[model samples]
Target chain A: MRITELFDNGEFVVTAEVGPPKGISADHVVEEAKTYLSGITAVNVTDNQSSVMRMGSLPACVALKNAGLTPILQLTCRDRNRIALQSELLGAAMLGIDNILCLTGDHTKMGDHPGAKPVFDLDSVSLLHTACQLEKGVDLAGNPLVGEAPKFAKGAVVSPCSDSVDAQLAKMERKVMAGAEYFQTQAVFDSEKFIQFMEKAKQFGKPVQLGVIIPKSAGMAKFMNKNVAGVHVPQWMIDELAADKEKAKAGITGVELAAKVIKECRPYCQGLHIMALGWEAKVPELLKQAGI
Target chain B: MLITELKNKDTILSLVSGKVFIINCHGCKDIHFPEQEAEALQKELAAGGNVTGIFTTDYICNPENLKLRLGYHAEAIAQADMILVFSCGVGVQTVAAAYEDKKVCAACDTYALPGYQGVTPLEHDCKQCGECFLNLTGGICPLTACSKSLVNGQCGGAKDGKCEVDPDMECGWERIMRRLAQVGRLDALKCPVQVRNYATDDEVKSK
Candidate 1:
């Protein structure tokens, strides 16, 4: 079933993202998707996330679809121009891939290949609007296409932890106007902030899936807290994870924390989008513990 | 007005091994221009050999003004083997245009000063993507400020409203958010502006 249907059908939607392999070997990509297929409404395949070179998200999404799991092809504008972007969208439609998540992507300087020139021909907002135009049998310039237009269950991302809620909501309204059927926010660690964000976002009357990251250890949490943007890990949560020196105990605490966030945010959000951050094996465990 | 730092003294000195004349633009009087670089170069050049002349001016970009100045030092400039220009790219180009026979080189490496190309440098830089979103981002240019250059929202590398690439630098979006909130224009961030025209630079260059 399509992700939009899952959201519209009144089932609490659950989505998870999977990073494409950096190399050609993607046998593990499929295996990773299978690990939590039963627990997720759909799986998102990231496109060159963090500006790192990786196996294309398109083929990975195809692989996931073949594995009997719904795949949301993650597309970014950091590497492609409008022509290439539209061509890939048509390709996804041909492959029976119906879901997509639009992102502007990080600059190439942030990746292993800092020398690569970034082609941000279209930002996330523009890309979403372009996708909507392609769905209507026209191009971004409003020119008619020769063939049939593509169809997609379009999705976008938002940052609930932005410094100003009004500004963030304004961006959210643009995404919705651009035809973003749903939203999966950046990793949110604070439930109070997310609840407040939801209160404003709900006025748009769209399904928003809160992002939850399951940090492996206190050190990892601290690293994300200090470095990652749009994410904040409360000192109390860090102290809890750092309470123990045992790695196993830290991992357990991490799960408990993710569960706590999920339980707290579930009341306000339409669903949870679990970002395992390479800890894919723990996603199912988190779902079970959160009683989802 | 942009930042132009002098190249290594030894490296520059080695490039012009004969009689040298220096031309520096004090017109913009930009803080990032390293106002003393021309004098330092003059002193170092004098130590090596005869320093022909130091032509100082405000509008180095004005070809007419530069030509007028060159007329005054025609003899000194004629004797020099190379002319070193200390200014921004526009000034360097103007100086190069004034002399066709002489080897004109930039003694300073020109860079985009943070913010607009105006006199005073701010904490922001605009890539000049053409479609101005400053009205939306509270006058901050996310295209050049954010390490990721994310337009719709902030990246995952922000911590406590600071950029992940540099902890000391406040996140551009965070600053934009705060400013937008203060002005009650936070709603401007909602409507996604049209796709950025990458050809803006090309069009300007062609003109």
Candidate 2:
């Protein structure tokens, strides 16, 4: 089913993300995606999620579709200019990939390879506007096309747990104005803080998907809290995960913590996006625990 | 041949507050005067608004007379707070060199017409860098020709002969193929595609 139709059907939905393999082949990641497909509404395929280059997101999305799952292709403006971006958008639509998550992307400086050149011809806001224009069958210059352009259900990311909530809300407002139909927030751990964000986001009248990151270990949780921008992991959760030394036990604890957050904020959000990273297998249990 | 008043001479002298005698050699005739635009400026100047004096020649047409004209207009320019050029051609360059520190503004958008064959106002299109890959894909530039400018191939929206974005223009690749076929250069279309540089910095620097 089309993602927009699925969204309109209005049940509490579940989605998960699968990072593409670093190499050209999808064999390694496709098997991981299959485990969570039945349990989730759609799976988001990341585009060079970090600064490190990897296999492109398009083929990975094709792999997901071939496995009978809907794929939300995450597009970043860092790599492609306006021309490349529009071309890719049309290609994705033609290839039967509908949902798009537009992102400004991580700066090249922050990626594994720091020396990479960045192409930011249009920022996230402009990209969203371009998507909106294409959906309406018009070019970026406002000229009407001879026929119809493809329709895409565009989504954008927001960081509710940013250092300044007001600044985050302002950016969210701009994204909404630029035609973002849905928002998937940055990794959110603190429910109280996210609830505060929800109160402000409610004005824009769009669905918000709270991001849940499943940390592999206590050290991973600490690493995200300190290094990842807008990800705030409370100390108590870290201590709880730290208590479990066994790797299996730690993974279970991470899923359990995410489930708790999902259950708590389920009333406010449309869904939860479980970012398992390498731990894609645990998402089913996490969803089961949350009773979704 | 044309007589135009220097409206700001008195006010400019008052601002500088001196006995300023200004002579304009370019006179006010050769500057291309669309009757309506000239009338509008005259009304604006007569309403006691800022009006720099007019020029005698269309700057682009009469290049040789520009130096002589600038020599005539130098006094008014030196005395005033600003020197505005309403002419086209070499008159602009002449005045620019003479009044190095004076405020100078052109009422015309700048463009280079072929040689001095008379100004054939060119519309700004995609900047044509020497790197011509349009030959490989067809006559349509994958860079400027394509609605989306897909490098590898046409986007999904390339329906029939029209673009999915704009149905009127033939798809960039389609145009390229047709043009190559027409010129019988289809065999020459087998080069490895090189990415076109659309950098704004190079275009801006050239301008």
Candidate 3:
């Protein structure tokens, strides 16, 4: 089905991202994914999201699909050039993967073993344009494909709380013009700030999904606020999580906070993309409590 | 850049400048390609353009070798505005660490290679992280071998068993199937398997 159909249906659209494992067939990863598939509209399979090479994203996506769930394949430009990127897109189309999230990956220097090299031949913007070309059955250099190209419901990322919000908006506009059908923002905490950013994003007339991270612990919230780019966890929320010394109580409090955010942002966003990190199982309860 | 292999101390010392310096391991005085790149870069800087510092080092085979190599590249990296790596293997990581603070770029496209070569060459065919599912699915890697990682897929563009992406190469899965058939292991294609997550926190050091 087309992304437009999915959006118009307004089905409390919940999407979760699952990281593939490094070794062959680990029951733990599959078990983790199965825990939350029932609560989400689709599950996203990340493509070496942070540039630390892992098992390929496509197979993981296919696994999710095989599990009677819809999967959105996350593709990155850090490793592949225009040619490889286009080929992967076509392959996704053939595999019945209708959803894709485009990204410019982290530099190789960030990965373990800094000796690994990076391929940044094309950044995210160019990748967006390239995807547009493939949808139209042409290559980046303007050559026509020998066969018909596959159609994809393309999406891109934006950090609404970026230090340079204007710069982020400009890139978002570029992505929209380049055939991005939807957008998912980075982790958001401040609803008022997000509302302010949405005032500008509203002009684009495209659907936006608010990114809600399920913090594993109070410390995890603090770490994300300090280290992860474009992610902000309010101190009050952190304190609440810390107030609960027991692990189970902390988990409950964390879910309550996430549910509140989901409720507050529901009116503004078309959907919510939950990044549970390794806490995929808790997502259903969080969503259920939010009345989503 | 005209890359050459460095051979001796005089050649190494001759290449040193505020813009060019020796980037070699300890207990050794030899010139290598990295040194050659440095000399060329020095010339480029002298010619009056905003040029950066260059690397001069070797791919280390041991921890001691790594330390010596890191120490040498760190000096050039500390002083130069940019650091460019021309070789592969441990050299890539060594230079990246030494020049972590500087702008780093690779001159060659890095790929996963076979392990037969002692300390596999930097140019690898696949980034093997020990998630080998190639043993299944006809020896063709749906993850890395296929240009598009499409399982149970062969694009209509496949002509006479060759990939439409490039006529000279066999389709990744097709080649795997052939190899599996040769070994009478075609039954390895059983249930669809999920791709493993080979990434680790250790793999992600910087951002």
Say which candidate scores most in DockQ: 1
Model 2: residues with Cα > 4 Å off, grouped in runs = A143-146, A247-250, B1-207
Q: What proportion of the real contacts between chains A and B does each prediction keep?
A: 0.52, 0.00, 0.00
Off-target runs (Cα >4 Å) in candidate 1 are A247-250, B1-157, B178-184, B190-192, B200-207
Model 1 error, position A288 (Å): 1.5
Steric clashes per prediction = 9, 15, 22
Cα lDDT for residue B29, candidate 2: 41
lDDT of 1 at B79: 91
Q: How many clashes (backbone atoms < 3 Å, residues ≥3 apart in a chain or on different chains) does model 1 have?
A: 9
Candidate 2: residue A179 lDDT (0-100): 82
- For each candidate, report its DockQ versus the true two-chain complex: 0.26, 0.02, 0.02
Taking the tens digit of each residue's C-alpha lDDT, what string does model 1 give over A1-292?
5688888987799999898898887789888779755558889999998888999999998888888888899999889999899989989998999899998787687888989988877878888899899989998878898777888999988889865555567777878888899999988889999998898899888899999998677788788766666778888888888887485354688888889999999989888898887888888788999999
Q: What's the residue-level lDDT of A209 in candidate 1? A: 95
* Error in Å for residue A49 of model 2: 1.2
Evaluated on the second chain alone, the candidates' TM-scores are 0.54, 0.34, 0.34
Cα lDDT of model 2 by residue, B84-154, tens digit: 44433233334443444443333322232223333323221222232333324333345566554444333
Alpha-carbon lDDT, every model = 0.76, 0.63, 0.61
